[model samples]
Target: MSAGASGVGGAISAHGLGGAKDLPIPSELAIAGAVAALVVSFTVLAVAWREPRYDAATSGRPAPAWLDRLVSSRALAVTARVLGMAFFLYVAAAAVFGQDSLINPFLGTFYVLLWVGIVPASLLLGPVFKAVSPARTISMAFAKVSGVPEGQGLYAYPARLGYWPAAAGLFAFVWLELVYPYSTDVGPVRLWCAAYLGIMFIGSALWGTTFLERADPFEVYSSLVAKLSIWGRRDGVLVLRSPLANLDTVVPRPGLVAVVGVLFGSTAFDSFRESTPWLQLVQSLSGSRVWPDTLALIAFSAGVALVLTIATMATGVTSDTPRRALPDLFAHSVVPIIVGYIVAHYLTYFVEYGQQTLIQLSDPFSRGDNYLGTADLQVDYWLSSHPTFLAVTKVLAVALGHVVGVVAAHDRAIKLLPPRHQLTGQLPLLAAMVCFTVGGLYLLFAA
Candidate 1:
């Protein structure tokens, strides 16, 4: 949604990723994709497995012995921690010493590398942030020095607060990204990083590392997406769960719906805010665009949560599972959709700016130092140049996500709803999912 070099800002501008974009898909193709999603929804309902298929304890097959051993080894763990700390320190140095210009690698690293890159990294590596998180490393050091048990704090983490903190943290991040006008400034972004580390450290110390799992925005987001990866565990043995099964294993926790809502909604809002109408409206206004944009962001997020809640609860539920609990319980179904949109929204930005970040990292102070041996590398714009392929890929990604979401919601419905109500109970949620998928396609087409 964001694009172009502007008068006031440089680098990845506040509104643009700065490159040629895929032409909008034809209206016919967009309609075809939406129809495909609906057709697949019913096809799954009519012929797919009726009994729930995933169980965290039994779903995946264990990996080979040697591979599992290497993966779970302490040596590998320590190496990952050291590498993580090294990367964090490298970026921290840039923030401390670099200029506030567009060339600063910190900007690309934050907005592109870390924020957008985490999705793919975690997908391949499984909870990658947890492996190398600086806050987590420091928290461990603190626990060891203070003689506290690992991952233990002053008290037990309350179960009632499940994921709420992470949801709030994620919102804060998207606000800073999408709403806060000074998002690209070095000082402001640096301060946000400092505050993030500070909060992560303090929270981990008080509540142990458990706090980070449910509160550190990056950790939570990465872990959520990791569920879609082929890597998983069965009874503490390394195993591979199919993405669908892995997705079904997600625990139904309080505030889970809000977390997914913020993720999907923020992305949709990014497209909306960049639309021509929004641009004209904001431009013609008399004041700062902050409040209008903030309200719009909030509305997008809350709107997703509202739709999910209402759709999931509209049908009759059993005595054991309240209608109110259905949203969070069914929330996992939306993860694939979120991941799909993430891929569509950030693919070009991540690949193009990612290369730029590598180039800039070699010259963190903007003084042309080739410290990382990557300063001489040039970015490949092949992906950006091939607009047709890129556009088609985006539509397919959205459609694939929609299909997975439909299957997930369907499985959960049949498993939870009474047999008589199973099919009927899924109709409302199916419609809601279709709307989301169509609207997302519309945004990409219109963007």
Candidate 2:
């Protein structure tokens, strides 16, 4: 978590949000982790499963009929939508009416739960946000009332647009959280959400739920991570597969590389901007930190995308596949790596601040009320207290994500590249993956 203004009716501080800073990960551990990532990456390239193993159309055995029926039931779908809408409205009321204070639940819901929590929730429950997305629910309701079929819109969604809208949405979010000075402020953040909801509603009206699938940042992100969960579907039947195999099922789409760039780069920028050197420089600029931070954010995001584009395209390609399409084809492999790094970056923050948020949620109005009986609960800071254990966990998570990513990319390479160039074509992507891991470790150490 990052620092901010301490109390109600005050603007956010530029330092960072949340409370209690993490001790910098030890230099030795950072090096060891980076070395391990490099070693495991090459090892996977050399000896891992070489044949193309995961196919969406044929992989994964059908799950139990009863379980599938329960999961796909109309009653269950309605229940999920109702619960999602109810929760959205509950926190939305807080955003609209509650005190502009750190104690407000709206801030927590937007920043921590919705933004950070979506990863783990989707990993565990498979596209959990999509199930409970209020945007989708409201759009469906409007369609029904207007006598239009649900998910049927005014026009066919443009395939070429792909995930670009989602990429933009993601950049907007990271900008708000990392670069925008008043991110913790109630009014600005609320306005952002209002605009998000408005755009989602209008887009869904124009392009149907396909717009949400392609444009909703949280949905796109959650769905990507869901590919790593054991849960899956084969011909609309619930099935289970190895997470790696499940991950291989992701279909390449335009702007996927951009999504990868923004997620990873913004996170790196988050750490970089908070480093002592950066803080001192920005503070001495004799101007607002907003411009510097915004520029840095753009640089980081663009840097990642550029590296990815060059790395992916700097390879042999068959005549059947355009060189330009290679980046999106390989973009799915970056999902696990991103998830792994995010866990390392935000683990303690989410666990600790998430608890704080829950306790605060019990008293959304800040009126000395404990409606949820959780107001008195205390956050356990054991993770923050044990710096070594936390550091090791972060390193392990990064390494594990790297290994999975390498294997995913390797499989895709075998499937997509010419037989003669399969091994050679993968070299650049593998190197890029190593740079991402090592650079992430360096940030964990230096920043």
Candidate 3:
């Protein structure tokens, strides 16, 4: 019933590409993952360092001077921007000029490469979007022409606005992808991208690059995931930090909880909508699924934000920081969970369709051009044929994400909570994380 998959079986699918799905994982494996999550949560709480281990101001060692020079070089920055812009223009050309058939590269490039592929790309290279953001590039040119200095706008970006704009932008994109029926239609999808582009330009014009940093959904998501990468900066110098240590450096800001919620919730909803129970329910209802799916998406996102708020705020707090702030403070903990769900849900779509996209890229006009030498390339279906390996990989990814999240939350809790309440404070959050992990596992198994 959802736009992602046809009501019955057909060529249309959530991603442009679809094939045999991995069978439901064994129930025993799901149970084991849930149990492992519990064990890891408590183990970290009981035995992990009592004192706070990560301090952004003091953590991480500087990179090798040559490496730093390479990373920070103007030539490298210019090249990244040029490449990103080139790719964007190439895809935009296809979207604007190509046939509206399923084979068009735009859909896969947008939904698969840009959306799903950003995670792994940012994992290896920190904040790839921010570095190569076409909007940022254009904004910089505008500022220079207007005689404005870099990083400054007509007025300062409101501190209170924080990441809320980015959260809303993220929600908008997910709603379009997951709930809108015409998401696969090139025109609607193109319009959505154009709107996103307009917003980025206008917001940057008004609030400067700071607005883009906190308002561009892709930038915010990529930058946040980049925190889990080894690359970091201290005093404007490139340095490397452990993932845990780097994660702890995330600045708590307004609406961070909602950002994570939309991310995790939307992925969860993707799985839920594809499951048979929900599909049959939608089939029985027999109207447009737009309203139902929209409501469900809202519920899933709000539910996560609600759970996170109650879980983090349930603990006792010191006068130094209010309990209400704990949600954003601990929001970084769930970044790993988001990454996990992304891996579990989109791994096949990304790797498989990503290749297909490269192939299509060579023939952007659907003219059989093979310009990039990719049209002749064959997409390997090795993962699709190997269901067991795929299933185990999904379960393992979810468990590992939960484990990292638990440890992150534990570290943050101890650092913030009063001594008497430290251990007790984490219990509720721990329970909440377990439920999330188990729920995620169940969805992956059943979906």
Per-residue C-alpha lDDT of model 1 across residues 267-366, encoded as one tens digit per residue: 9998888788987898898478889898999999999999999999999888998998999989999999998888888777777777888888999998
Q: Which stretches of candidate 2 lie over 4 Å from their true place?
A: 1-25
**Model 2 agreement with the true structure over 1-447: per-residue lDDT tens digits:** 243322233322222222223445566666666667666766766676677888988889888889899999999999999999988988988888889878889988888788889989989999998999999999999999999988999999999999999999999999988777787789998999999999999999999999999999999999999999999998788998899889988888999999999998988887788778888999998578889988889999999999989998999989988999999998888898899888888787677777777888888788888978999998787886786677778788888888788888888888989988888888898888878887887776566
TM per candidate = 0.95, 0.94, 0.95
lDDT of 3 by residue, 1-447 (tens): 235323112423343223225744575667575667667667756776688888999999999999999999999999999998898898899999999866788877887788888999999998999998888998998999999898788778999999999999999999988889888788998899999989999999888999999999999999999999999999999999999899999999998999999999988888787778987888888777888788889999999999999999998899999988889999999999899888878777777767777788899999979889888988887877787788778777788888888889888888899998888899888888888987887776666
Evaluate all candidate structures by whole-model CA lDDT and list the values in order: 0.83, 0.83, 0.84
Stretches of candidate 3 exceeding 4 Å from the true structure: 1-24
Listed per model in order, the count of residue pairs whose N, CA or C atoms clash below 3 Å is 6, 4, 2
RMSD of each: 2.2, 2.7, 2.3
Question: Which window of ten consecutive residues has the lowest lDDT sum in model 1?
Answer: 1-10
Q: In terms of TM-score, how similar is model 1 to the real structure?
A: 0.95
lDDT, model 1, position 71: 94
Quality of model 1 by C-alpha lDDT = 0.83
Error of 2 at 188 (Å): 0.7
